[model samples]
Target: MDSLLSVCDIKEDVSYIIDLAIKIKAGEIEDMPLEGKTLAMIFQKSSTRTRVSFDVGMYQLGGRAIFLSSNDLQMGRGEPISDTAKVLSRFVDGIMIRAIEHEDVVELAKYSNVPVISGLTNLEHPCQALADMLTIKEHFGSFKGKKICFVGDGNNVCNSLLLIAPLLGMDMSVACPEGYEPDENILKISKNFAKDNNTEITISSDINIALDNVDIVYTDVWVSMGDEAEKAKRLKDLKPYQVNKELMDIANDDAIFMHCLPAVRGQEVSADVIDGPQSVIYDEAENRLHAQKAILYHYLK
Candidate 1:
């Protein structure tokens, strides 16, 4: 694959990458395949998992990571993404960008000579999707006959899950309020991908119908970065969709709970459920390191 700007970009190799991540996490990857590589991390958005995981993962793979915030890069000073992509490609083996605009991530990958990974974007979180898949595989030992329900705002993390889940042989459902559904084009593409992969996709406003008996019941914060302005409205709209104990009870008995972190306890998910025994948020977060290591190996090594 040239780059991973979206999960769909690496659809055919999704299973391979997940397998590599599993092996890497289990200490099965003996040799450091990325001994001489360097990854430049450009962050227009602040993060905890994306930043630390990529940084540490590179080190463990015998490579290194460079952190570049918006202030550190010329792009913050109005330099075009094309110029930044071209220049950074000459200095680093790969680029990982967490940006406000999905278009910017696409533009960077288009211009860069090296592979560009979408660390996170307003439209999709491809790396996070990889980690989530890795976590699910670890919990259940396989993807067969599994269903995942994304409960809340259909934002970046949910969008990535929509695209990747069905591709990996898992059915996906999203329960969101009206005017808060996933992107139309992405939903269409994911549905098409589902058909070919023999899985299913569904969306609903009724949380009960959507969450019913799913293997994974996942949620993300109602308000996201750059969304502080609409926080009150978002909280009001998504309050009913929160993954509380009652909501969790609607899922399968063995269902695991997940959140792409920086989660608000009483907003998208309750403290009880997120801190409960079934929650795998920490394991999911940890898998970010292994998954991105596999991504690094695939593109840079």
Candidate 2:
């Protein structure tokens, strides 16, 4: 793949990368696949996991990563994305962008000679979904017939999961407030994929129904980075969907709780539940390193 702007770009390679991440995490593979290469990490949005994971991942692969925040690049001002992409392609083996606009990543990929990875965007977060799949596979043994339920605003992370779960023969349910549902285009695409894979995709406002009998209970913050102004409204709308102990009780006894973190303990999830035994948030966070390493290896190698 020339770029990983969406899960669709890595569909055939997902399992391979997830398996590779497992091996990397276990230290079974030590060769530096990206040795002597350099990765340009452009961040239009601030990050904790995405920043640390890719930087450290490149180091572990015996390469270098340059951290370029919005303020660090000419693109921060008014430089055209195409010009920046072309310039960076000459210097770096690969480029990874965490930006607010999905189109920015698309434009970078379109213009760059090197492979481009979408670290995150408003529409989808492919890398996070890859790590999530790895974490789920680690917990469950396989993806076939597994069930995952997402509770909260159906945002970028939700969109990525909707694309991936059906492709891997796993069923997924998304529960959100009426007006806060996932992108309609993504839902339609996921539905088609589910039909072909013989998996189910359901969207509902009833959180209880979504959690019932699922193997994984997942959630994300109600207000994402660009949605800070809507915080109060989102908090009010999403309060009922919080992944507290009572909600967790509704899921299967062995169901794992997951969040793409920087979680608001009292908002998206309760402090007790996030810190609880069933929560795999930390492991999930760490897998970001391994999963991204695998992705970089795929593009850079």
Model 1 RMSD in Å is 0.9
Model 2: runs farther than 4 Å from truth? none
Question: Poorest 10 consecutive residues of model 1 by lDDT?
Answer: 25-34
Largest TM-score belongs to which candidate? 1
lDDT string for model 1 (31-92, tens) is: 77889899999999888899999999999999999999999999999999899999998899
251 Cα displacement, candidate 1 (Å): 0.8
Stretches of candidate 1 exceeding 4 Å from the true structure: none
Q: For each candidate, how many residue pairs have backbone atoms clashing (under 3 Å)?
A: 0, 0
TM-score of each: 0.98, 0.98
Tens-place lDDT digits, model 2, residues 52-112: 9999999999999999999999999999999999999999999999999998999999999
